[model samples]
Target: MKLGELFQEIPMERVHRYAPERSLDLITNESKACRPGALYVAIPGQRVDGHWFLKEVLERGAEAAIVQHIDESLPLCQIEVPNSRRAWSALSAVYYGHPSRGMMVYGITATNGKTTISFMLDSILRGAHHKPGLIGTVKIRLGDELLAAQMTTPEAFVLQRYFREMADHGLDSCVMEVSSSALEQDRAADVAFDVVSFNNFSREHIDQHGSLEAYWQAKASLITQASSKSVAVINLDDARIRTLQGQSAASFLTYGIASKDADLLAVDLQVSGPTVSFTLLIPRPVYLAGVDRTVPAGAWPMKVGSPGQHTVANALACCAMALAGGIKPMDLAPGLLAYGGVERRFEVLYHGPFTILDDHFANQSNIRTTLSSLSQMDYNKLHICYAIRGNRGVIVNRENVAAMAPFFKDLRVGRFIATQTLGEVTEKDVVHDEERAAFLDEAVRCGLAPELIPPLDEAIEAVLDAADSGDLILLAGCQGMDLGAGKILTLLAQRHPEQKAKILWPLNDRVCGQTIPHPPNKKETQQ
Candidate 1:
């Protein structure tokens, strides 16, 4: 790819360069990983700025640098773009040889359920024999290799690089969870998506976005950026979907449980234990060549690995996207039945005489939804070992505690253990023991007597000790509860070897207990 060709795609008129002939081999940030002829993007970060290390990147053989502020004295190729973040996205696409052009990319964006839907789409694509690459909060799966994710959506340059790598690996499709910040910053601008699915949204990231409307606009940009021929599969059940439909020029397909007029509708819903069986009604025949195939609407029995009504909704969205992407309706039934829930989404840890659920419910709605789903299950007593984060900023902490209050008010539980992940830093201040104590005390004042513990391990032990036959133990939080839950389950199995035969995890998978505690860091208050 020539420099002129790369610049042609970007909206910039003129670019200031200190070295134009530099043969860019790659774009990276890590000075150690800098290769000859590579472009080092100097990003202005909180802890450290790449601009400060320009001399280091240049010394390490970086041929070019993208900087927010230009230094004329630098002999290296310096491209002064309006925003380095946007430039990273453009440069990465060009450097990666525009891998997204050859692949069908589906950007799933929402406040919650983004991870679940991304997982479902990947699973469905695999079932249909399409090689899929996934980029989300949990991890980035590029064929056989998996790497822990540092962000819900990585920086634009890195994203393009990953997409190119996936393309090189012969992946037919890429599904990613598009965060609002990513969209607002134009991380996904250069790439064309085959489909963009709008899951339900709620009030979140207010601290970053400032307001709900701003957040909504950021999410809406994903749909607006799609090409005219692309498809926008939306959930009519969400009120925001209507506004999004008005903004998009792409072909529209709506799916919902409530709307009878939806392009795909789930009817005659049945919730039996962990399985949700429902009848899908697609009133119109899908036209294929000369044949107008009448897709028979019938009752489909499917078992989601996790137990939640939200999961059912996610399944419907998956089915809609799959069908819109040219997958047959018949294939959807089997795919749904074979679909396994993603890690940490209503993941059941153990089920012996007692049950343990490991769900990553980080928000208010998710917390409420998870509790509501558990209320539907047959358990004598629900013992919740809820680990709340203190560094979530004061507003989020209050919202989360308020959400849990209603569930605690209704359910009769043997014990409610409330613990905090100490030394966690957020956009706000550091969440220390004192802050957590205050939050827990507030919750207790609201009629929920939650036992506060310093470490998550101790909280798990307490929950297990309090639980007996027919008692349900739930470990709910976003941070590192997976390892804590796993360790407790393993200890329980070792103590009562006979109950190991009856032990059940949410997905019936073994929990790998591993804890990597965070190093202490100073917290800064949100502006």
Candidate 2:
């Protein structure tokens, strides 16, 4: 492709000997990934600048370079753009032939439930025979193939390349989690989304985004990015999302559990054991392909395999996306039930006379939801082993402890055991002084006494020793609890060696295990 054509959408500052016949087959921002015919774009980043590697890229036979400023020292074909990041995204889409345009793409942005919605949407699209691809926090799926995710959202260049791969692999639809950082970085600048959903938002990424408002803006930008041709699925229950009402120009599809104004509303809900069933009140009808009748407007009995109010919100968001895309409500009902669920979103790691559940309780909202759900479950004893949050600063730790304290005030079951995860987690995953002080203060203030154990392994063992057959053991936390599922399996082995082979299969289903296509560069639990 010609270098001039690729810069059509990008504002060019100057064009210095721009080659119209330069056969640029590959594009990269990283010099290490550049091939002989690749065009290397110099993007100024926080840690490193690609411009400094100009000599290396040119030496490796790069055809051209797109940069913020002209490198007068080198005579390589250069196209100077106002913003390299935007230019990189625009050019990659052009080079990849805008693969996302050929497929139905749903971009879900939320503080939570992005991964869950992606999986639910994948299942729904598949129910209609639309071969679906997924790119989210858990993993990347292209039809039958799965790769572990490196981040919530990939860089624009890498993302476009993956879309191109999916297009060639014969996937008709793709669902991805669009992170706030990704939006700020201009990662999804080029993908033409068919549907965009904002399930819910909470106080998260405050440190990285610098403020609550900045974080909200990052999430809101995704919904606002939708073209008039697209459908924006908004969660009416999310107070942050409610502010986005009458905000975007795209055709809006509203979903909620409590809001009667929602076009796709769930009512008459029932939660029993591991499943939750609800009556989906579809006031608006949607077309069903190759069927005599449309998805008739009425209360359609819908059930999700997962529990929790958050799961209901996720289900409603996916159902709204499918309905807006013209899929039947009847078809989606089965899909939601079929989704076995991703790892660590309140996954039951073990089930016997007692049950062991592991959850990724990263933020305050998640902690509150998980605790509330656990309180409702039928168990003689509830033992919670929480690995104290690390890396996340004082504010988050304060909110988390506050959330925990109120729920455990009555001590419905056994005492809570807190772990610093000494050897089980990375050094960065170790609890800080502020986190410790916040937790202890909140626990005492709420009139609850939680046992403090420094080592996560010992804390976990403490829970196991205290648990009876009719008890429920909850392994919870963020980075530190990555080893929770594995550690529990090891402990379970010691408790009952005879049950080893029968329960060993769940370890493969864990987030840290090979069940997902995890990149080699991604961090593992320190244990």
- Point to the candidate with the largest lDDT: 2
Clashing pairs in 1: 19-77, 348-505, 348-506, 349-505, 351-504
Instruction: Give the alpha carbon lDDT tens digit for every residue of 1-527 in model 1.
Output: 34444555655433455445556556666666565756677778667887887778778777677788777666666776777777878877886788998988888997889988998888878878788999998778777767667678887767887887789899989999999988987788877788788878887777677788898889888777767767777888888766677466777777888877777787766775676767777776533221222234444445555466777789889887776676766676656767767777787666667878778877887888888888788888888887676455556666777888877756667888876644332333346555576667678667778787757678878888988888888887776464565657667877878766554233243322322222221110111
Instruction: Evaluate candidate 1 by giving its C-alpha RMSD to the native, one decimal.
Output: 5.8
Off by over 4 Å in 1: 1-17, 29-36, 44-56, 59-61, 285-306, 422-430, 433-438, 498-527
Q: Mind sharing the TM-score for model 2? A: 0.88
- Candidate 2 regions exceeding 4 Å error are 1-5, 8-11, 17-26, 31-35, 46-62, 284-296, 411-415, 420-458, 509-527
Question: In model 2, what is the error at residue 75, expressed in angstroms?
Answer: 4.0
Whole-model Cα lDDT of every candidate shown, in order: 0.73, 0.79
Give model 1's clash tally: 5
| Residue 95 Cα positional deviation in candidate 1, in Å, after optimal superposition | 0.9
Q: How would you encode candidate 2's per-residue C-alpha lDDT over 1-527 as one tens digit per residue?
A: 77667766667788776786877667778887666668899989887988999888888778889889888788787888888888888888987789999988889998876777888888878777778889988788766667877688998877987898899899888898999998988989899888888888889889778999999899899888777777788988877798786677677778888887777888887875578888889886644222222445777888888777567777888888887777766788878888777677888888887888988887877888888888778888789988778877777877787788777744466858988888766566678888787777777877667799988778888988888878898988877787778877888887788999766668764555334443432111111
